[model samples]
Target: MPVSLHGQLVVAISARALFDFEAENQVFEAGDDRAYMALQQQRLDEPAPRGVAFSLVEKLLAFNEGGAPQVEVVVLSRNDPISGMRVFRSARHYGLPIERGVFTRGASPWRYLKPLSAQLFLSTNEADVRQALQAGVAAARVMPQAARASAAHPHELRIAFDGDAVLFSDEAEQVFQRDGLAAFQAHETSRAHQPLPAGPFKPVLEALQRLQHSTGGGMKVRTALVTARSAPAHERAIRTLMDWQIEVDEAMFLGGLPKGEFLREFEPDFFFDDQAGHIASAAAHVPAGHVAMGVAAGQG
Candidate 1:
């Protein structure tokens, strides 16, 4: 039976998300002429993959095909004149549905794009995508290489997140980072049983919960919370998930232990955290993303 993408939304991110091109320039010095030519070249028709971004897009298509819902990929670029067309053709050849090709001159492009009833935006650019997310877009953190390497056989899409910054407000994180562990633990313990307030990733998590409910309690997607908080302080985390009414297959309160081992065992497709050390280590195993905290009221 043909898979139905009728209610599924998927996004394939390129350039901005997949690799830090600007950072790469500092390392390899591709220079203006080479860079300009590479950008302008009709490279998609060639036999080999252009880079990790294309590979990620291909994987997203396969992942969609393996599931019950229909999925489409939106190629996101910035003012690339011909890149979108090439991507569209390549995607069509692979039998994946190619939705509109989205181009944005700068960050936060998804804000202007209309929301699909059911959708998931996959990208490696955590900060920019987070902005779109804050504006209510259904975005997921997907690494270009990971998307390519992932199996296409409908394996459960396991996603893990750190509680404070990735899943809930950074208020708790700030209290801890700025004030000190004892004070932070006290605050969380005091409100230990109370639900934590919503943060940037709240909507995205809620959307996944809805999908889980729609699937009749079966595990179409598996989620986990692996954080440094432990024991008495864990109640707040529990209460927050409960309040959201989202079911995470697992929760690990690691306290001060390094998260790499747990992440390896869980084998999540992607893991999100605000700490760079954790992200660096986890990325070596599973795709990892760093969530940027919301800007303060007067920062901009």
Candidate 2:
């Protein structure tokens, strides 16, 4: 029987997260036997099994085992085409239901995927995903760990994101990245009362907000923001969220502390950040994603 997805959560991940996409590409492009041999050795030596992020794949299997509202995962990729094969092999080995696909030559894959319930699509190809989400597809451009974590926790999807790039505009991130923290803080403080621009995640947040409002009894889905900025800069983050009228169950301004400890305590199903270091650390405690906020390779 076809499983009914009403209120079910679906997540889509990228092949890069599954295997070493870049390494594979280098080998294929160079066609070097030594490189291929080295790649094979590296793959063999890795602690986690090959194909798809093992951490994520394992979580999906566990979710299925728990068995409540059905949770499904779709692995999406274009480069390293054979990556999907490895993902399938791993899922079968570990016992998880994960589908795989490559993007259409020109069309958006998300358009055809709307039938999946409560979708959470993750991709390094943020622009296309953002375009699809803006067109009203239930897609959220996230990293692999976040995608898996979101699927694992079906009852209450706890998602944590960094304020600047993950939720708000990259303009702030640009300022922070190009200039120094003081300059970025000055800019944010100037716009403290003013509304910050909505980001790629905004539409997804709005959709979740609508879902929260329509559903009975408070919010079944929860959100939180753990930001580096504190005090005055914190007010801007609060004001921006308030202006949007979105409900975030928790908000922590870590000042300069690394977010790993706080995120662990929060126990969010998934967390998102642009920095790999943060995602790498958080992925240990929770499913974490690295937001690729632009056009991805092999994307049309």
Candidate 3:
């Protein structure tokens, strides 16, 4: 029988998103693949340091430790096969049970998400992330320089997401952006009973919810919907989740407050948002990734 990843919460990540390849990425950015490959080959014996998404991947893999696999982490990278050697070695060093990967040399690797059945895709390359989003996969562009995840939640996998363009569709958000705050509020208040359309990351949130229930390991999944909407507008967002029958551990209606301090308290393994400003703020307190789609990406 052919191997399959069906029914698993598969996450596709890039070599740089999995490990600190920023320095070597600089070499690649200088437009020399051979030199970059050589540098990675030279460091094959030395394990690369953990990147921003490392903690999240580690905790998710923990779910598969004691029983049937409930989660899978696949390396979908743009690095060449030679550099992929270092990636696997680093995973082995960290004891991360990541066993599969795709090294495309310099080619775009996001196209493979379909076959992998990945619910999430993380990469340092914004173009790759955007492409994955266009393909309808829950994707994020990891900020390499973001603060590392906190050790506070070793037994728990905490993830945070934005509302508009993330967990729910950007329909209402487009109103807010085009008109003003008042119009957005009125629009949402009028349609408070109608559930908003599904967003790109909704499937990811649903998968996490399922994983939380079926995971055989001791690790737990905690999720939060931290959004800029408040009061009247907030009602619709909450109602939308209710319509979908998904539950979140926490929900923050900050009314456009700076998300850094609030995220500091949350201490998520990772945070996903569509807006660049919110990502920049949260990156200071915790690991954050940009969901480059919807109204926030100006693509909705």
Candidate 4:
């Protein structure tokens, strides 16, 4: 029978997002494909260090041991086939059971997400991430300079998400953006019983929940809902998750406070938010990704 990714939690990651390719990427970014290819070829045998999303990918792959694989991690990068050799070498050196990849040279790789049935797509390229999100696959623009994940939770896959325009729709977020805090709080308080509409990442969260329930072998998934909503507005976010029958291990309603310190303490392997400000803050202390959706995300 032909192999299929139908029932798996497929994650499509860029080489730069999965491995520390920033230094190498600088050469590539200089607009010289020949130089970039030569550099990668020269260092083909060298293993790249783990990047920000490395921990999350490593832990998720653990779900496949001694059984039918439930998770699939595929490299979907813009690097040429020659440069991709180093990427594979790096993965093998780290013992990541990743055998699939698509090297698109300098083209956008978002087009391949559909074929992979990707539940999540992480890339350092903003254009690719925006394209993927528009195509209905949960995607995030990884902050390449973000701090690497903490080694404290080796056995657990700790993931955190922002509330508005991430786990929930941008309906309330639009209100907040247009009218300010008072109106946003009042709107959320009034609609505390109503569930917020599903956002781009909701499907990813639901898939994680299912995987958490079905997978075993000493691996675990812990999720957190970290948001800027506070007090009265927090009720609606809680109710929305309750309505969906999804449970998170932690929830932080920080109001307007900085999320970096709090996320540092949480030590999540990956964090996602719609706003660049929150992503900027979290990236300093933990690996962070931008959802690039909703009003807060802006156009283009």
lDDT of each: 0.59, 0.59, 0.92, 0.92
- Candidate 1's displacement at residue 226, Å, is 1.7
Model 3 residue 252 distance off true place after TM-score fit, in angstroms: 0.6
lDDT of 4 by residue, 151-201 (tens): 998888899999988999999999988999999999999999999999999
User: How high a TM-score does candidate 1 get?
Assistant: 0.74
Considering TM-score, which of the candidate structures 2 and 4 is the better prediction for this target?
Answer: 4
Model 1: how far residue 260 lies from native, Å: 2.1
Error at 162, model 4, angstroms:
0.2
Q: lDDT tens string, model 2, 1-300?
A: 885656544566555555435555567458564564456445643332433254444443344453353345666554333334554655565556665455342245556456554256665456656655555443334443332333444455566777765677667767766787898889889988997887656755665565445433222667888887787778888999899988788899987687877888877766766565666667666666565552221211
For model 3, the local distance difference test gives 0.92
Q: Could you tell me how far off, in angstroms, the CA of residue 278 lies in candidate 3 after the best superposition?
A: 0.4
lDDT of 3 by residue, 102-208 (tens): 99998999889998999899999999999999999999999999999999878899999999899888898889889999999999999999999999999999988
Instruction: After superposing candidate 2 on the true structure, give the runs of residues whose Cα lies further than 4 Å from its correct spot.
Output: 1-120, 124-154, 216-219, 294-300
Q: What's the number of clashes in each of the models?
A: 2, 1, 0, 0
For all predicted structures, in order, the TM-scores are 0.74, 0.58, 0.98, 0.97
Candidate 4 worst ten-residue window by lDDT: 210-219
